[model samples]
Target: MEKQFVLMDVDRNVYEVDRVLNAQTTNIRSFGSEWSIRLQRLHGGLSDGVDVVWVDNGCTRLAILPTRGMGIWKANVAGVPLEWHSPVQRPVHPTFVDQSRRGGIGWLDGFNELICRCGLGWHGAPGTDVTRDADGNVVSEQFLPLHGRIANLPAHSVTVEISDDGAISIVGVVDEAGMFGGHLRLTAQLTTYVGSNTFEIRDTVQNLSAGSAEAEMLYHCNIGRPFVGEGAKLHIAAAEVAPRDSRAAEGISDWPTYTGPVQGYAEQVYFVRPLTADDGRALAVLAAPEGDRAVAVRFDTSTLPWFAQWKNTQAEADGYVTGLEPCSSFPNLRSFERQQNRVVQLDPMGSVTFEFAVTVVSAADDVSRLVQEVADLQQAERMTVHDQPNPEWSP
Candidate 1:
């Protein structure tokens, strides 16, 4: 392993490369919100890379490798990059195209810009356009910028801290009322290492604005293909699934009705049973194919009670793996009544938090025991229902 990746010391305001890169990466360094982290790739069998930090700033948010149209040939946190072989596709480069627009709707906290390279549809009805190079490979040109006006401009407060082991912790507040009043806040802490195949991400959000401001967020993980293909099986303990009633994109809800005995992959959101392993922890599972591996998400019950599952129906998109999101909120908030079938409310000055653990394994068969442990933790906890209700998404 080469020192291919770098880390920033917030206290000293500098970046450091811990290991050397071999067949994986080249000289790459980018800055985001005062943190300058080095990027690296893994050589040998699996496909992998290390990226850091997430902020709303254009440069900061768009600095990661998967940005624009650059594709990750094989990248995985578990050290197992899904193999792409067959009469079909082979691993490729990042594919990113810019659709200059105002106000990013589907951007999902600018997180989507990190990898998907497509802007959210919000600024103008929310849509995406992809541009491919002559070889038919996706390539990115410039950063896709998304900005909005804040009602009560809170104090701009931000913090970044990294552990000895490379776990990065961040505190950011989109302050309202002079940074003292309740505001939109985001908290994330993550650690990734090429030597250690596991990468952990934890996030939280708070609302401080006046009145009932609808909030939208997504755990947008842009996956790569062939590895994330039809061979993959999405295993979640969630009891129900929801979908946007009307969207050009592919999802479960496009099927017309989400009531009773749903089968096959449809663009939909899932409502999981109040999950708790025997130790009282929330657990969710995602399993890939046999030669491939799977990912699992587990969290405590109080902080995050909701789980959402999103997958791209289009094979042409970045990758084929489903997004296993355990969040306090979802991107389609306004449609909660009709699609999600539930509402999560944040009273004035009130906040919510979610904590979970993620582990990657060699096989998908481990999902059953993992789910059973989650079920053994306890009974169903009642969730808050918003305005309208859809039986399919009702928890």
Candidate 2:
């Protein structure tokens, strides 16, 4: 039987304990491995009032934040940390974040999670978003903030599930709606198994409005040392790769490779069309310098057709990290993405789901196996590397 715990239900007016854990009182625990689940709220600084849920499956531990759109704050798989050091040092509360600050790029103030969703309504660079009627008369015009409001919105309801066979799931529901804006609900679930070095995220975004609504999402999966250092590499099967701008074009020849932290290295982003398996599953890996440890993200091209690789190898204090992003559209201005025909339009009460799995391998043998698999997929087709940004894919 699958045991369930209701953490929060707005409609039911239920708000459980401030903290919960698996103990003798509950009489339910995973048998072999040391498994546990805890829910707590932060009390100080920027993290104040943030609701955090922790799940430890013996081999893997995940910290999830329902206050941050059910995003995974961080993860540790088989003793390998899957997170980066961001200048924003805490799990910031949404109240402290002004999405419109700093010229629409203020989303960086709360972007420290290892895996953060970038959309519910729209996820891209901030700009004036205008919608016009069939005859070109403007219907709506407004400035959209950076990355949308999903990342900073709190979940209205959350539930924790434990299966008799030792599977753990944390599900949360967050709605992005307002007066002029339509309603978009995000149902996110994070699942893992006891003693396993893997976890999966399943997110479903639904349009709860009477009229059609625009939708876009990007999974920004970030990592740092020891998975991103000198000699480390990003292993992915890409049929084509292009720089996002001229700055990124400078390093196009060595796009997939990495170097240790530099004092003044600027960030570079590459847009890619990844080669996928027959099943539409695409993979991206960040290997450590020693090649014995690695973290991999498995996604589907059928749901997420675009990929963005962000490399920011600046000094540690400046937030040295890299991002392996999978998205429905490129992270450009919403207007540009719409011009490129990359946004999703959801009908009334319609929904679409996105799913991905993360795995960590510490054994050299296992890492080598994944490396070889990525290489094989890469070689299946001749890759086209654009020296400069592709006008078709970038603004």
Best by TM-score: 2
Question: Candidate 2, residues 1-395: lDDT per residue as tens digits?
Answer: 98888888889998775656564545786468888778788899999999888888899989999999998898888777888889998899999998889999889899999999999788878999887778989888889888888999999999988888888898999999998779999999999988899999899999999999889999999998789899999999989999999999999999999989999999999999999987778999888899899898899788898899999999999999999999999998887888788999899999989988999999889899998889888888988999999999987
Quote the lDDT for 2 in model 2.
88
Backbone clashes, each candidate: 39, 0
Whole-model lDDT, candidate 1?
Answer: 0.37
Candidate 1 residue-wise lDDT, 15-117, digit = tens = 4333322222333222222223333333332122223233211111212222112212233433344332222132211122122334443222222321221
Candidate 2 collision pairs: none
lDDT of 2 at 255: 97
